[model samples]
Structures are given as C-alpha cells and as structure tokens.
Target: MFARIFADRFVLLLLATILLASFIPVRGHAAEVASLISSAAIFLLFFLNGVRLPRHEVVSGVRNWQLQGAIFLFVFGVMSAAGLAMSHILDNILPPILALGLLFTGILPSTVQSAAAYCALARGNVAASVVAAALVNLVGVVLSPLLFALLAHVGEATVSGQAVGRIAIILLLPFALGQMAQRWCKPWVDAHKDLATWMDRISIAIAVYVAFSGAVVAGIWSIVRGDELAWLALAV
Candidate 1:
C-alpha cells in the first residue's frame, strides 16, 4: 500500500519538483525565461479547458447559485476568519511574514484545475466545480486586495489596472479564443482527453516549480528554520 501510494506519478513529480527547486532554482535571465514559459503553459492550459468544458455544463453550473454562494462564503468568509484566528494564535510562534502569508492564503480563491480534477475523481459535479472555482477567483480579484488592506493594514499596491489586464490576457483571452474555436476542434479534443489531462498536470507542475524557485531566490529556506517548517507543515 505504501509503495502504491508513493508510486503515484503526480506525487512523485511534485516531490521531485520541490527538491529540484530547492537544489537548483532558476535565477537571473533563466528565471525570466522560465516565468514566460510558465505563463504560456498556463494560458494553454486554460485554453484547452475552454475547448473541453461543455457550454451546457457551464450554463447549468451557473444556475446553481446556492452552491456557488456557499463555496464563496466558505472560501472568503469562514476560511479567512479561521486563518486570521490561527495567525493570532501563532503570532508568537511564527514569523510575522509567515503568519501574514497564512492569512493571505486563506483569502484566496479555489483553484480551478485542482478542484475540477478532484471533483472528477470523486464522481462529483465537475461542471459545478469549474464554475465555482472561476467565480471564486473573479470575486477574489477584488475582494482579496480589500481584505488585505483592511485586515493586514497593508498598502495593497498589487491590485491595479495592469494586474487586471494581465489576468485578462493570460487567462480570459485564451479561454475565449478556445471557446470560439471549440466547434471546429471539439471532436479532436474529446478523442484525446487524456492528452489534455497531461497538459494540465504539466502546467500545474510548471507553476509549482516557478513558485518554489521564486521563494528560493528570495531566501525563504534560509529565513525559515527547520522547526518553524515543521510547525508550518503541521498547521497546513
């Protein structure tokens, strides 16, 4: 059982990526190139998502307002409150930035690809999961910054027209184009759904690598001690 669990490709790949990032993170010009590649991969990932996701499913999913509302409230309200409480409780134990990072994570949206993947695995409503995840992110773009400003008393310089434009270009534009092309490409996409799944996994792995590389570049490992990491792991 342990071997079976450990042999899972996704689990192994994730650990490998983390280890790789820790040992040899991309830096300088290479980091910039990696970031661009990661962005393109993400764009392609969402584009394929648009092509594959059935319009009828999205329509039905959107109609389920109650479910969407519940997800939003849980993510933004309950989870954020819980994170704030935990930060306070661990204020003395955790670094101030780490505690703030925890709070920031709580206020974030539900991840689209992972949520939909889990829903599919559980034989749940994948369409609803996709819709809920998208809605959470759309709302989060506005709410997260405001929440940070109020709760953390941070200047909230991150949210701006440029940020919104980047979101539109990287995420919305490709998805929209894919949707427009879906009628012609749907058959091919459906026949090769496994390919799309692999692409999604690759994109996610790339994102993880980029994130960890950034943290490494910022000296996160050096600043965070072993015991502190243990506490963070337990808290997570």
Candidate 2:
C-alpha cells in the first residue's frame, strides 16, 4: 500500500501544489523570480530527459513510421481539429483563456513514458506503443506549437514567435544537446535512474506551481466560476 502511494506521489504532489498556489500564489517580484526559477527547472528537466532517452531507441522508434504516422495524424492533427471545434462551441460559455486552454491541451504531446506502460497494462503492443510514443513526442516538440498557431482563433490565444523561440531554446535545444551527449552520459543516467525520476517529478511540480501562481494572481478564480469549471471538466 505504501509502495503504491509512493509510486503515485507525483499526482499527490501536483494536487498539493495546486492547493498551495491557490492559498498563497507568488506575487510581484517574487513571481518574476519564481518564473525564472521555473524556466531554469524546465530547462534542466528537458536536458535530463534528453540525456536519459537512448538515441538508438529513438532512431529505431523512427524507423517504425507507420505507427508513428498514425499517432501523429491523431495527436497533432485530428485532436487539434476537435479542440478547435470545441473551443468555438464554448465561445460564449467559457472564459477566453479557458477556451484557449482546450486548444493548447489538444496540441500538447502524449506522455511518452506512460504510453508503453498503459499499453502493457492493456495487453497491447507495448513495443509499438513505446516507439510510436517516442517518435511522436520528438516531432511534437516542434509540431504542437505550430499546429496550435494554425488552428486557434485570432485573439483567443496566440503562439507568438517568441513563444516558439522559448519552446525551442528552453525545451528542444536542451533535449537536442542531451541527445548529443547521450553516448557519454547514458551510463551515469542508467545508474541514477531513480534520482532522475525524482528530478523529473520535482521539476514538473515546480512548473505547475509557478504557472498556477500567476493564474491565481491574475484572477483565474474570478474569471472562471465554479459551474463553468465543472462544465469545462465534463466537456473535456
């Protein structure tokens, strides 16, 4: 029981972090510093992720193009279209930022590590799921933002050139650098996989906390009422 709960610590951490942000959201100069720290945490998280993945596996994952292509079409294509349609449907009902979030979530990549595990649980093709997830995510790092730009409305939200640059510089560039260093770093990474996993969890929690801190201060509660949030959850 304890092991299971410990294994689910990331989820618990996220819930706790959200509550903390709701009660005591970072403000003013502290908010700015938190943002910078989150950025750096994100940079390190992606860098570690880059270092961790085996390049050979990634290349192999790429060679399985049919599965990758299908997933790509679904994740970056069909889902984006669905999100765009739904965002429009809820235009009068939901807040603009919340509606935009619908599109953003649609464009976001699949959780690579979880895909294979889920597939295994369902007694599906775990190998195919693993490779397809990896390849799709690798491409998605670039494709998601571009797709969002294409699908979203004029003012609801915008993925500016700067946002793209940040994604590239802060997210993709580090991952690429990690891949380049993978040959030398792989052994160390393998030995300390548990440490890396903890780092990943902590970094993600920090990012979420910082983001919600801003949202909390920006009147996220005032803008999104309780009923609307319930409806949004159901719609999703």
Measured by lDDT, the strongest candidate is: 1
User: Quick one: how many clashes does candidate 2 have?
Assistant: 0
lDDT digits (tens) for residues 69-115 of candidate 2: 88889988888878887888887888887788888887787664355
Which is the leading candidate under TM-score? 1
RMSD of each: 2.3, 5.1
Clashes of each: 0, 0
* Cα lDDT tens digits for candidate 1, 1-236: 88987977877888999999999999899999998998898788778777887888868989998999899899999999977887777778999988888888778875665676556545688667867887787777888889877888777536667766777787768777877889998899999988777776787788789889999999988899998998888776
Candidate 2: C-alpha lDDT: 0.73
Error of 1 at 204 (Å): 0.7
On a 0 to 100 scale, what is the lDDT of residue 120 in model 1? Answer: 58
lDDT of each: 0.81, 0.73
